[model samples]
Target chain A: MLDSERLATDSKPNILLKGTKEGLLLLLNEVVSFESLLEDLSTLIHGEKKSLFEGPDLKISVDYGERVFAASEIREILDCLAKRENLILREWGPSTAAKLSLFNSSRKFGPQTLLKGTVRAGQRPVFEGDVVVIGDVNPGAEIVASGDIYVLGRLRGIAHAGFLGDWSAIIAAAEFAPMQLRIADIVSRAPERDGKPLRTFMEFAYLKEDSMAVDKLDSLHAWTAMARQSS
Target chain B: MGTAIVVTSGKGGVGKTTSTANIGTALALLGKSVCLLDADIGLRNLDVVLGLENRIIYDIIDVISKDCKLEQALIRDKRFEHLTLLPAAQTKDKSILSPETVKELVGALKELHDFVIIDCPAGIELGFQMAVSGADRAIVVTTPETPAVRDADRVIGLLEKEGIRNPHLVVNRIRPQMVKRGEMLDIDEIVQVLAIDLLGIVPDDETIIKNANKGEPTVMKPDSKASLAYRNIARRILGESVPLLSFEEAPGFWGKMKKVFGAK
Candidate 1:
């Protein structure tokens, strides 16, 4: 019965597993108490036995072995291991079956994605790489980084992507409102806080013709390609 | 050593120039060597405020460009023996004074005077940067309003980023009676948000206007609250800890009856 819950079809520890259309969901499993379980699990994760918290962000679904512990304890152990490795844990909860829908559902393969959390007042997001946040960036928040930026929500805060002078950088969000936007050296600010709202499916923003431009996200690939070419 | 103090506010028209001019005159009247450098560039007014507009044979640009010597560009204050003015060039804006050039000017002036005061332009432009760049310390001036304090916080952040060692706050145009009623942003509130040291609190004083018109600074007056406040700031710059002065309404007779009767 335990092995049934344990989806260790591959030589992965199966601590964190989620089936994605792109690839097998895997995560670093470091909290297993038994030395042998840690070793076996480590081998399964990398195919070559190694310690946890190494490599890039991986999507993982927990394979509950026959010997089960409290759900909360598992979360806590994962959180502790993440903290030790300077990693941010994005949880798709294990308790409720609603979250399981996300576990079983197919997620699109992407280099990365923008988060959807609200950018509240006084909060800031400054990343060194590409960022795509799926939520609204509120007023008084700031986003500064050295790569491309995309916001699937309102880009109201001060967003400065490509601060290190990558002119090909872009900032696209669902809504086209932002207090100030900067791609490379070009800067633009929403003149009036009271701007018309956009109820749209998707939007794209990037440095175009020496300034910032907004367009449909579906049409992003062409210009983004051009942006890279011109640079 | 001479003190180079930059009076700045991130927002415009918060009495930065007025405070700098008055305090420069005040410190000079106390017999300290003082130089007031107006970094406002195109909007120069320290000369006008000091009533020395007619004596501008050479400007700060002349001194920096070495077109004329620093001594010739310096306008001597008529009233104070030790005070001098470095008027901003009428044609040039703040961009003319690069950070390196500004540091050189102030560093040179610091050797010759007891206080080298700079009048900063509003906002974080090249002028504001120049005004504060050569400062040994900074005096962040703010009014009892929201925009002023918010901008002041921005200035504080920039100053801290530039590695300015000591930054002090000066609460200007405070209406204490309103503060007592929660009608105004009190000194404590502004200080808390900026998280800086408080040098002094200046109340709204009518005599200040009269003094400005007469080309006199309140710092020379003994009993004036504004004068006392400036003096306190001066002493603080001199490495002395001074207590803040509060303006108490005349505690005498008719004041009480007027309050009780709600009289104007």
Candidate 2:
């Protein structure tokens, strides 16, 4: 075999998939490019299909050493792995010392999408998990997150949190005058306040007794505390 | 060495052909060599609107089918010395020309002209793809209405997806009276909904029909607001920062009195 082919088929592949107590830990070679790493990982999973996944389905966690990836890039890697039916991606993050502690504490955290600029009109950004927007959601834009949504700026567009019927998901923003808001299956329109100045305050929306309710975010800590007690 | 711009409106009758004609004429008037390609095959109207329909001996189909050279298909406009038109074949189907042919034709045209303005078809289909194939920039035209604005929004989204960044918007046929009466959507609302840079605003003018029927671009008429608007748009396209034209009419006696007295 050629030298490159020999290196490619070596026992210590670029992607190391080992069975661990925490299910499966996917350790990627930091030296390889991201694209090549993905290609090798795909080939490895497909090549070792029967023996590697002979038992029950298991969650696979990826540990990338010292490399930081954007939310979308990480999601793309996880999605590539998810195409294989035998593997379920539970979580993946940089294996920094700080994050390693969080990995040990909780392993059930799902994906989250973080968008930095204003979501403009005609732009629809959909996320599978929690979404955090650093800027405004202008009218004619829409954000659909399967989990909670937190916007650092004004929300004037359509925001659908708990899109998959998770009623506990909440929508929070610095300013909460949205054209239309939806939490799960329920839809609500912003009430018209003619001639009245809009309340310039932070607000959050959640389902209270099966009805959508908007509350001032000033008491957000108390609200979460109350919810913790109720749950 | 010329820029190719594709003028498109996802929904028809929002004035893509008219805008292309006027902008091309305006550019040619500014001493730039301009070629307007009518990409709306089987439904070509740019030639008719530009008043060069009778002068077309070889169409773009002839040029593409190798029956004629690219220069043979180009018809010179009598009004503007620098202006030229490549009329589409009315009898040919849109499928006759693929995106590759358009890219090749535009590449050739770019070497001969300062600007190659393509008039795209109505829908987001093969025709639209062919028109925008070699375009370095895009111009999306829409009227101040909900349906037009909605389609323009979709077109802008598609343009961005196709890697056409910063597609300029031309809100056409805006009625200032209806806007003041709150019956029609305003330019600001349309611009807000489209979320694109404002290129120009053409007021609803009967002169457009009169000039178009005469096979003349409205911009050639010195007194027409639509003409002035198109000129400003051409200037803007040439990297000149021109203030957006106001469509509002001068306040009348009662309006001026109300303004002076601070009355509603």
Candidate 3:
């Protein structure tokens, strides 16, 4: 009888509930309307499958694949579960795409953020696209950009370019004495005994062979020209 | 109204209380009416540093709680006629005084004095918040050490976030010999890192400790290097443009003789 009931529920493209070692996994359908999902969830808990959840307390983890659940939508799902006293929500796992979507919705890419004056210690300025600083980035400050990062003055702190994983992005500064550099997924720290005098010329950091490499800014023009000719 | 400057360092043992006592005393010696407010609460040391602990009948908490009048809580300094101290309470914690209460107290003190110097407690907590709430400007004190400069940078960031822009930097306890040996961070390095205007730099002098032990501000001793630095800072605060003092050691007998003979 339980197999037949599961067969009946499997025919519909709605919520899929499966038992695992961690207790129960509830996979909510992404294409179905949220109202219908909630209705189907309530009916399955209170209707024919009621006896299945009648045992001891069972942990339930929700996996909303490619669907971002709003607070109200989550509360509705919780309300549907609250009808059954034995079911407990142990985890909420949102899809990676959905998590990235949430961040993308807040900040738009393509445009640069221009910051004037020094970015002192404890100041972190983050941007979706390129970031241009007109002044110094002092020690302990951080600048993060989804694209390139350009500092007109000293860049002595941490500068993370291509924070969203754009490997083509770069970080350039007038005096490059950074504590750390991150380009895309690559990270590099300044060598110990970095007490050398400030460089006279501008320098930049880019991802080379899956590692961060530094070179004088003059080399970037030639590299870009070569890439343009090759393409 | 008078200006209120809060002396703060995010790290302890960087001489916030000592700087406050000395700066306040230096300002008073310049003929300005100065009120030094000790906001450390349970760990009050500004009074003892000023040697006015025995004269404190009431404290800041007494004034804030209305247990005593503001005038009654202020202890007049024995040496300086224009200097007064509003001691911190010993038993109560910093939570006893809210930022609004401190703002009000500082407002009242500003009306009666030319400068209200608040000695901030260490660390960025409620105590630091309460001390910073009443100040019109800030004086960030730091030593030449890396940790001290880092902490000072953090405090300067917080002060800027609180809308105190262009806060002055006072690099204290600078050992000239170490700086000359390239073993310590020099003034230029610290100023470059902090990117703030240098108000003054106080040299590490044994006389400062001796004077502090004797309940006398180093600024009172006219011959001490630290005293001269503090006086220059006070003069600058009074809108005087004194040149920065070079930390070079005083000339020896031969150097002085060469100068007397007009020889290079």
Candidate 4:
């Protein structure tokens, strides 16, 4: 085993390894050069300290403190960790105040489809990926998407997002008076009033736990925090 | 060279036949030769509404089957010199008429008339298809009710799918008093939901029922509100820009007193 104090003081190590309740946590220093960090990580995993990661099915999470890695650099780090057969890469991301962008991240969305006309009544537009409608969706129309749904106009019809059961998907519109909204497996209907005043600002609907919750577009921080914690 | 306009409403009793009779009469009154074709075969009522039921010796089925010439089956309107009526068969089912046969008949009629107005039957079945197959334009008639507007939306979607783009809308039987009290949908609301151009708006009036019962279209009675509305719609169809009729009701005695006291 390696001495933690000695490694911290000697040569100012760029990588630190700690055991957590979930599994192993690797914290990478942002100041060090990328090449040196990769070198140190490889040396630590393949050298004399390899016994720490030798356990069966140990999950490892990498937290890059205030550092953003390019796609190729992340691939290089993944290749270095792939050397250990028992270690599984669980989660890897930047841990900083800028993490609020996790909600706007495009990684979870599938291919997007752009529809340019109004979805009139009796029209059902189904897509395998995300769907973006540039016009109004009438009362009897329906839209089904496997990922997120974005409507630039009034959404007066039925919208089903995460059709294949992706719970994190969301439905958003400029005028959010939908006849019915479905996110993942949960469904919500409009209130029982014929004259519910139309909303002026943009609104969005998302799944909280087991039910659907609606909120204004300005309060996106709550969505970011919820998404980060759920994932 | 003539334009064929099909009047359609997916749901029943939204005044498809009444609109056809009145609009055709209004157009003929404007000095344009017009032909009214009733496509509701088993439920034929355009002739009765137009007061030409007694003059129909041969029906559209006779014309399609070559049992009679198209001119022989066409009944000249007793009131308007330029108006003609081709009544539907009383006993024949709507499924007997194919799209191709209706297209050929409309093509022949177009050669001799300035405008051919088709009265489409309720429901989006073969009758509706046959009526719309020969039209160059479409006028979707809908009331302000939700079911009627929903059905109109569905029919407009089908029309657009069949390559009839930008169909006009005519809101029929709107009561101005209910609309003023917010108890009924206004014209703007209906137009916004349907997302189509407004052709005209007909208010609900007792004169329309009386005129229909007398076998005279409401357009022939110039004193009624619906008659003026139909005239405006016909003028608009003739490429004239006519402002929409004001649906505001006259102020009551209390309202006039309040207005006199400078109350808004």
Q: Any runs in candidate 4 off by more than 4 Å, and if so which? A: A1-104, B93-95, B250-264
Residue runs of model 2 more than 4 Å from their true location after superposition: A1-109, A116-124, A134-142, A151-157, A173-180, A185-203, B248-264
- Which regions of candidate 1 are displaced past 4 Å? A1-231, B92-96, B255-264
lDDT (tens digit, per residue) of candidate 4 on B1-264:
799999998999999999999999999999999999999878889999988888889999999998899999999999887799999998854455899999999999998899999999999988889999999999999998999999999999999987899899999999988988889987887988888899999999899898888999999879878999999999999999999888776799999999999998
Compose the digit string of candidate 1's lDDT tens values, residues B88-144: 998844345687898889888898898899999998977777888899889889899
Model 3 ranges with Cα > 4 A deviation = A1-109, A226-231, B254-264
- Considering every candidate listed, which one attains the maximal DockQ? 4
**Candidate 1 docking category?**
incorrect
Clashes of each: 14, 0, 0, 0
* Proportion of true contacts reproduced by candidate 4: 0.71
Chain B fold agreement for model 4, TM-score: 0.96
TM-score of each: 0.56, 0.70, 0.75, 0.78
Candidate 1 lDDT by residue in tens digits, A67-131: 45566756655654354343344443434333344443432222454565555445566777788
Q: What share of the true interface contacts does candidate 3 keep?
A: 0.65
Q: Rank the candidates by lDDT, best first.
A: 4, 3, 2, 1
Name the docking class for model 4: medium
Ten residues in a row with the worst lDDT in model 2 chain A? A100-109
- Write the number of the candidate with greater TM-score, choosing between 1 and 4: 4
Q: What tens-digit string does per-residue lDDT give for candidate 2 at A113-205?
A: 899866765789999889999887877789999988999887878999989888778899987878888999999898986646656688999
Pairs of colliding residues, candidate 2? none
Better of 2 and 4 by TM-score: 4
What lDDT does the true structure give each of the candidates? 0.72, 0.84, 0.86, 0.89
